[model samples]
Target: MDLRDRTHWIFDLDGTLTVAVHDFAAFKASQGLPADRDILRGLETVSAQRATEIRTALRQWEADLAHAAVPGPGVIDLLEHLRGRGRQLAVLTRNTRANALRTLRAAGLHAFFDARDVAGRDSAAPKPAPDGLFRQLALWGAHPDEAVMVGDYLFDVVAGRAAGTATVLLDTHGRHGHPDSADLVFSELSELTSRLATQPPGQSIGGPHASQKS
Candidate 1:
């Protein structure tokens, strides 16, 4: 549907805001973990002490990656437009909160969001779960129908759907694209900005299947 009507905007960091760069499979391999295993879940099977150390190291590694974060095309314009309209923007990333904040600064987007609104892996159950979105909505005193989640992966779409908010999927870098599950799909942030520019009040972009394939 049309995103302009939504007041609360929850976004996934990493690939959604910045260009994709983290090599997750490689990270798992380096940890002696199954490449396809979900890293967080995998940690659950380890000794509590060992898990703590890994978690500490993982957060640090992600914080380091934040130093090189780069914003996707038209991302600044999109954020400016949303903020000008008084939208509440929050991040719900799977990274640690410290790393997420670091990413915002490194990408020159720290001014766009408040530190309190940034939710990371430790912030909630980690997406594909709706806990973080629910918390954000609660903080804003907003409803699911009044918010939208924008991200570049299945977990984003699933999490938003579970939370009852509209979902927008960015199928960029040829990664984790799932149009059938999103209320809107675009190849780039610039395209989404264009739609917002022309969107008429009360008009939604389209249904779940509506998308602009790259």
Candidate 2:
């Protein structure tokens, strides 16, 4: 539970590290999908040819967005603090590896992680599934208990809980829609970074359990 000493940090690339620019609604509309449908899951039910076309379009959209990627508030500082503490860092995104790398480089965060540490949809099943998180943990040689999954959405919390890792929700808007699965909630990355700088190792952030169960 001492994050400084033992924690491995697995992060969601898009909204977590970078400014939220992906308009899910727009992306869905572009694919002729319902506004509320999960893109990946929806693609699964489509014809192979159609699915390929949608994926190709989605990839192009993501590539374009990558060119405009901007770091979220405190992203650089928080990442530097964690790196200075020797925490293992990795990215588990639902994006393609190529897109993830582009965003990371564009946001100036590419140095914090190696290519192997960044797992995208092509690497494993996406968030809300434990596959990508587990895969990253395996590569890091760390157990779930020694890692924390940080993201800005419910899917991230669910995936972290499903993988038996601690979950930190970056709910910048104060929406408490998915509190049950999150071990800690912060309105800003800076809040978490500040806590890490001031709190003792193994300190609980008001969670019933310091480490979550799958």
Candidate 3:
């Protein structure tokens, strides 16, 4: 479980890397949905009714808000450290590729990843499905045992585990429900940076498990 030896680092967007300023709730508000609609409940309801359109609107708003995304605490320094260590990195988000690129560019982080390295909705089914992670692993020519996933949500852990990649939970609040599959959990990006210092180089970051079966 040494993190330093990890070759590939796949990341999630939204609550994992940046605070969502224009999420489902914000989108609903902009669309003139009930002002008092329960954010979480309303999403599931609308999703079942206007799945395609809701996804489209959400993607558009996410792109527009990406330009406004401020870097979460310690994100830049952590990424810099990882890059310095020669780790390959990529972003796997549920949004459209266009929006993902726009967000990263708006945050002045476009240089950190390639268009291919940033797979969004264009890749495959979203998180909790593992298709995107599997595709990324295939694209990188990396074995499941050589990579790690850093994310903030349960879906991220689920996808990572399903891909056979070790999960590193960025538990900002220390309150999110624990993921039984996570190999390691971090409270912040800075914690991840510090922990990486102790990992031995060249050790695998993932576990030995079948991926395609799930």
Please list the Cα RMSD from the true structure of every candidate, rounded to 1 decimal place. 2.8, 2.9, 5.9
lDDT of candidate 2 over 1-214, digit per residue (tens) = 4455547999998989999998988788877876667898888778999999998999999999998999999999999999998889999999999999999999989999988899899999898999999999899889999999999999999999899988888988867655556877777888888778887655654432222223
Model 2 clash pairs are 2-202
What TM-score against the true fold does each predicted structure earn? 0.91, 0.91, 0.80
Predicted candidate 1 versus true structure: per-residue lDDT over 1-214, tens digit per residue: 5677888899999988998889888777777666556888878777898788878878877877999999988899999999999999999999988889999999999999999999998888899899999988998899999999999889899999999999888887646545677888877888888788777787557524347322
Q: Which residue ranges in model 2 land beyond 4 Å of their true spot? A: 201-203, 206-214
For candidate 2, report its TM-score.
Answer: 0.91
TM-score of 1: 0.91
| Candidate 3 lowest-lDDT run of ten | 205-214
Decreasing lDDT order of the candidates: 2, 1, 3
Q: Which ten residues in a row have the lowest lDDT in candidate 1?
A: 205-214
Relative to the true structure, how large is the alpha-carbon lDDT of every model? 0.85, 0.86, 0.75
lDDT (Cα, tens digit) per residue for candidate 3, span 88-111? 889998777787888787776777
Q: Could you tell which candidate, 2 or 3, scores higher by lDDT?
A: 2
